[model samples]
Target chain A: MSDQKEERGLRELYDQDPERADYLAFGRKTETDRRGFLKGAGLTAMMLAVGGAIPFARNMPSGLIPSALADTPEDFTLFGKTGIIIRNDRPVNLETPAPLLDPDVTPIENFFVRNNGGVPEATADPEAWTLTIDGEVDNPLQLTLAQLQSDFETVTLRMQLECGGNGRAGFNPSPRGNQWAIGAVGNGEWTGCRLRDVLQQAGLKSSAVYTGHYGADPHLSGEPGRPSISRGVPIDKALEPHTLLVWGMNGEPLPLIHGGPLRVVAAGWPGSCSQKWLTRIWVRDQEHDGPGMTGLSYRMPRNPVPPGAEVPHEDMVVMGPMPVKSVITFPDTLTDVRADEAFEVRGHAWAGEHEVQAMHVSYDFGATWVEAELEPPTNRYDWQRWRARITLPAAGYYEIWARATDDTGVMQPAVVPGWNPRGYGNNSQHRIALNAA
Target chain B: MRGRKLRTGLACACLGLMMAGGASGQTSDFGGLPAGPGQLETFGNCTACHSTMIITQQNFSRRTWDEVLTWMVEDQGMWEMPSETRQIVLDYLVTHFGPES
Candidate 1:
């Protein structure tokens, strides 16, 4: 059958019954190909032709879906075109489907996207983009991207950057901000100069206490004077070996959506601290009160609070390294497994600045736990891969849970952590249900 | 070989969408929100900067919605909504995606 005829046939099928089109397109009933062949060789050819047009077929449903559905950018790497839950679009906020995550470093494409404000109108010229270091520094320096490469030593390390409110959806009241589930966190290899090296070149003053970060994304309201977000980290955290002024992600130039021509990879802290489209690093003599630092933006109560209790800003402490956490990246929740088969459960675990000392898996909802094989981290801030195998005794349904302990002796809580108004740092045990039938 | 894999992937996606049984695109219209008195107005205003999915996904109470609106205006630089329109949207949101309890 001619390809054009095949294409026409497929298009006609789509135009008629979208449901049937979906069924055929997905090849769910491939066993009935003989029946389709009976219709004609054209139909069979069209099925084969659909493979070559996968990219096109993936988008064909857009025309059929209601126009109220927003259009995703064609070029940006998406975890899954249909799997991700987009929370916003101006400063794009996309959540990752937990299942799409890679057990190792998250590829730039699968990495969850979180933007504070609208994307910059102008694309940065890597050669011309400059970063300025000023404020309490003895010698303010303005260095272009080219100079940043030539003047400093470059290093690469695998690190995890997680939004403070990553699992905020678990909050009982369901916090007011972006309600991410598990995909708001990712581990990636970052290539850049150490933030300390850049600060050293500028000669930090003894009084320097914090480093304010400035990025190029504009405010959502289109205000020129106010940036969308301009947060900072403590000077000590800025000087940590893993804190980087990175231009590369997963061995490629940082994607603009994930912050590029320049951004800070402030490892072990809330992703907000790692400013994107970073243009300037201003050393401050006092704690910097930039865009997201005030009140309870990223702060949590120093002591646990009642799930619904409110705490004033003074009683809240600035968010630091995240608590110990683990997420199952394999066998996704609710997957069907063969009864009596020993299946491997795999996941990734990380603890803020501390190492993931151990991981425990429970098959009977938390009644009993067994140690999972924990793989050592590849780098200082990298997540540790872990796995455990279990054979179902009988076929029914089962819930698998994973909990990790940090070097600091902090273990994942069985229930959601102390809830704040914003619902930050919810390092609760991760669980997935599967049917054995 | 890659072409075959791509075809299989597309086929799987189609089956998955069929099983889910709704809009087949990456995003949904109005995020499956039910049409209401202020649906259009809410969509027009809230979606100016984001998808309607953002509004539909939240389960905040009326009080929390008010606070969120305040934060968006004061900190996130969202323009202040006129009181009447604001009331309409708030009522619509509270009624539709209000506190889960």
Candidate 2:
């Protein structure tokens, strides 16, 4: 693509999704230009540098920079009993263990951390941190945590928040972003005021079609004017009873790593839609094009393409709710099983925007499958617990596969659904290898 | 505390390698990567943005690795490596972490 063409494409992208355009633009800006840009936006570049300016180069020890940085103290625990994988440290992208996510309500600690930019240096103080609701609204409002609590009814609900590229590692050709396994998702109880009620308080104008969320996190390049992530959702989805400006998780104050103080709990949509460390909500006349919104960030090709084929931006569609998927949480891979006895296989199944209708288990590499008993979902948007007992027909190395069907009758594909440039949704069957002795 | 211990352990390992005259060891304690030609180059170039864990976890063909490197440089703002260095790093990655059946 020519430079002019790319620039035009980016401008078009900004028109549609400014957040994603800003994300892309942040990396392209030269250091000199970046400083000028930050100053133009009324932000101090020095403050951003102190906040965490891509420390990988400056802090790296002499010789080869270690995989894990030494001088930089870990802001949070990087590993747990679940054997969580650390992808990056500065911005902190941690993946949960798939086999450890059997619980219906994922513990806040176990929930995956996906940060696009550096954590803000300013520690959140609920008393002082305020959320501004403005743009295309009849009554713009600036409400603090206290006002948020006293002014609206607080409700709690269990919901699943999943990265759009949760299973990017499963792609054959693979993608360039974070190579997440099937662990970049979690179901949690979020307590907050309904986004609809909060929006109604601001009184949305007739032209409001989407929203743009702003958060405290700084860009990875340490640009103060740019947000790490600032995506939004449609007005209807924003107004859903379940959409919330959440302050608590699992009955406790929201953890900073998980976007504490205030965050949007946009259940069912890609987790990017739920902006963390939320500080502002801008109602827009069109789609809120924020970072992670354009150029295959959270968008996927509408139709499957041959592996490694490049598709134009026009053919891509924004990823909304995820697909039906299941994870084998018990009888982990390489587990030893007695051939003479029947053993129970257990796991969790979830379908975004739709309830899981049924689940099936296959012991012979999906040659044959048997229906498994699925416990009803405890709450809307929560994963369903599933279990099945299987008697090994013969002693050998066997693979157990789990497949879930959603209420829409869409079943999990046996392999990656389709090849996209970025590997957006890969809800293939979950397989666990076991030793049947 | 754990980070400090890990750094100390890595230093000890490197010293041991130097004493043994094994300039290039088979594995590194840095990110548990297998040491080979261009390993240091790869680490120095890539770890500036992400942890070695990200690269170590991926298993891809040389072609896919090349594509990933191109995407990083062209889209993700990774500094473009010299052609010869890129080839050496690509070879090391392909030999150590090629596609799995």
Candidate 3:
């Protein structure tokens, strides 16, 4: 498709001034700066086309205009073009309902999207934005995108970025959290300045224990009014060798919705702490208290609750990396046997920070366990991919479940604990039904 | 505010027209029985972060709705509201969205 036509089409469609549609859609292709305009417009359209295709493919039910201008009560809720559908935030038992894609990469187009507030509209220029680092630093610095790119020794790392609520649907009596599907994750090569390098340049003092990062997006109606989703990283994690102030993702500039211009890649930290649209960082002697930090939401129960109960105050634990779990992405059928004699069973497994020590597969729903080959961990913090093959024990219906244990000995629960108010931490054994011929 | 009023009027007019086309045949899952079509209004409030499919797909009793609201407030981190506002939200759900008993 002609990039110019696509850009003109989008501009005409979304342009606030309805009359601008004619100008954008059919205006005389002006001779002035036409080449540069087409070039830039082409790039923007390419980005939007890829980004927009995602919602239609999997994010939600198609065609949801952002809440910024949704006219009616119904329009406010539904994105008109995308197939993504939202549910009333309530607690219920959620099962991971879809097949996974590749074991290593969760494609951006397929990654599940879960935001406390609605996804913000894309910005025109993230590079023009600035990052302000202050608080307990020898030098409080304000740096721009170009400056960040050129100032420090840059680094790249392959990491998995997952929302804290990535597996909320796996819980029973699902808690009220961002009702995300399996798509709330992505594997990307994040490139940027190491946060530790930046901190060393600023010269962190001994008293600095916690660091806070802020983003540029305004707190809007859809999110929690007070606690915007920002969090603190311990000085050590902040200064970890691979911790990054990322600008590029998957070999390109970061997309606006994914925290363009700048965002933190705190590999393995809950998606909560990798602040998007990051604009500021503070080194504090004590813990910080932003809404994303000690907010009433996002806290996990100190202990598991029954099927229908609340977490007592003393039992509240902060939410973190998803529990170790796996899923079957192929042959998501109950009984239709495949004629292909070789039935390959494969899926993805991830641990928050610990290495996936082992993955056990059960053809008979935990009655017997078999060893599955493991893909090396993505990073110390990211999840890893795993695969295995099984010979059909005669053409028959079969149930498959996979579980993983981290180095810390955390095993997937066969049955999830009771639901809490905020749905968090749903690391249950994932089961799928299939038939072999 | 004027824009909202005008939009509201226009929406009500559209809904009235949809209803006049024999409300009997339209909107299948919801009962034709009287309790009022508060579905649109309830949807407007619930979808800030959530999708309406959450409610449409659910089969729950009023007690479950009450339990859900409590869970929304306590677990999902929704801001607590006055007892009266809570009652209005609950009544709306129970009246328009009671489970099939």
lDDT of 2 by residue, A160-190 (tens): 8888888887787766567787889888999
Q: Give stretches of model 2 more than 4 Å off.
A: A1-76, A79-82, A122-124, B1-49, B55-101
Tens digits of per-residue lDDT, candidate 1, B1-101, equal: 23566556656566456446644443334434468888876877776665454665578878888887787777776778899999998888898888741
Clashes (backbone N, CA, C under 3 Å), per candidate, total: 2, 7, 35
On a 0 to 1 DockQ scale, where is model 2?
0.10
Q: What residue runs in model 3 are displaced by over 4 Å at the alpha carbon?
A: A1-100, A222-227, A312-315, A333-335, A338-340, A417-419, B1-86, B94-101
- Each prediction's TM-score against the native? 0.80, 0.75, 0.70
Which run of 10 residues does model 2 chain B get worst, by summed lDDT?
A: B22-31
lDDT of 1: 0.74
User: TM-score: which candidate is best?
Assistant: 1
Question: Which residue pairs clash within candidate 2?
Answer: A17-A289, A18-A289, A19-A289, A19-A290, A19-A291, A20-A290, A20-A291
Candidate 3 DockQ, CA atoms: 0.08
Ranking by TM-score: 1, 2, 3
Ranking by lDDT: 1, 2, 3
Question: Model 1, residue B80: displacement in angstroms?
Answer: 3.1
Q: Give a tens-digit lDDT track for model 1, residues A261-358.
A: 89999878899999999999989998888888887788888888887676777988778878889999988899999888898999999998899999
